[model samples]
Target: MKTTLSTTFGLLMLSAAVMASATEMPVVKPLRGTVESVSNNTLTFTNRAGAQQTIGLTDKTGFVEVSKADIDSIKADSFVGSAAIPQADGSLKALEVTVFESSLKGSGEGHYGWQNADGSTGTMTNGTVGKLSKANGRTLTVNYKGGEKQLVVPDDVPIAYVEPGKKDALIKGAKIVAFPAGDGKNARGVAIGKDGFQPPM
Candidate 1:
């Protein structure tokens, strides 16, 4: 009876060890990061630990750590790795990036002091005008005086104008006059004329 009990305990210990090993394995996902360095198909990255580790991009490997879907849509000949920081969730957050090519460039106009979806403020440049629109969450949906269009603006993009009008007054049930920044451009801005009409603000 003692020998039989010993064998059963040994089996249970082996099963527990296998289960622990399985649970400790890291899950692989398509991740993009700025390439610290690259050799062949292997790229190194500064992980959340501040230590650099190399990863092999195989058929099973997903893309690296890009937040913007537009940036992720970009195709590249070579992989660029960047450092990743940890998020509240266990997912890796990108700190820096190395891109192989320039992504699509576009601009739009909207409220100069408009609040962004990410709680940032929109800054308009002086004497420069682009079509204005309300950002639909993170998506750039411009609502110009004329019409609406989907625009993609870069993080480094600069706005050209910051009007001094009240936010509520600008959109109050008033007629909006929109004209392109140039004779041939689609750029436009909304303005309430002083024709006996009071804007909401």
Candidate 2:
């Protein structure tokens, strides 16, 4: 009887251990905020309400920093932001970020038209060219033909318009259009049109 009781107790203990091990682990959500401070292996960000939080840097994280080359890429008043993604080797990596500034406001020397998805066309002799400077923050100004206009581009606008001189090197005259990639997200890319502009660099 004693041997049987001991065996039963051992089985119960093993069952309890298995149940405990089956418990779910906690989930970690993505963190979002403005960078407050940056260090070699960590970054501190302030939330919308001004609360500060720090996150440890990891291989899967991304980073962006200001550089002289980046400054010359956009208009004078444009603001820039960067992002870092983590790499598989446990190091921080840089993610591409857009810079926003005012749009190029001016009259089109040649006629330009906006073709709606429904196959309707609208002409803008005084067409404005604007780009979303950063991920989704503000606008950057570009000179079209002659005037100044504000273009409210959405966030996630891909590298649509390259600098004039660099156009040949990037996309050989790609026109900007909304390329919606499901889930309510829209991306800006060169469209298939008469001009046959190239894709962004």
lDDT of each: 0.26, 0.29
Per-residue error (Å), model 2, residue 53: 57
Question: Number of clashing residue pairs in every model?
Answer: 25, 27
In candidate 2, what residue range of length 10 has the lowest lDDT sum?
Answer: 184-193
Residue 199 shift from truth in candidate 1, angstroms: 41
How many backbone clashes can be found in candidate 2? Answer: 27
The TM-score values for the models, in the order shown, are 0.20, 0.23
Candidate 2 per-residue lDDT, tens place, 31-113, comes to: 33344454654445553355765545433221211112332354443432222233355322222223422222121121223
Residue 39, candidate 2: alpha-carbon lDDT: 65
For lDDT, the strongest prediction is 2
> Which 10 successive residues of model 1 have the least lDDT summed?
100-109
lDDT of 1 by residue, 177-196 (tens): 22112221221222232332
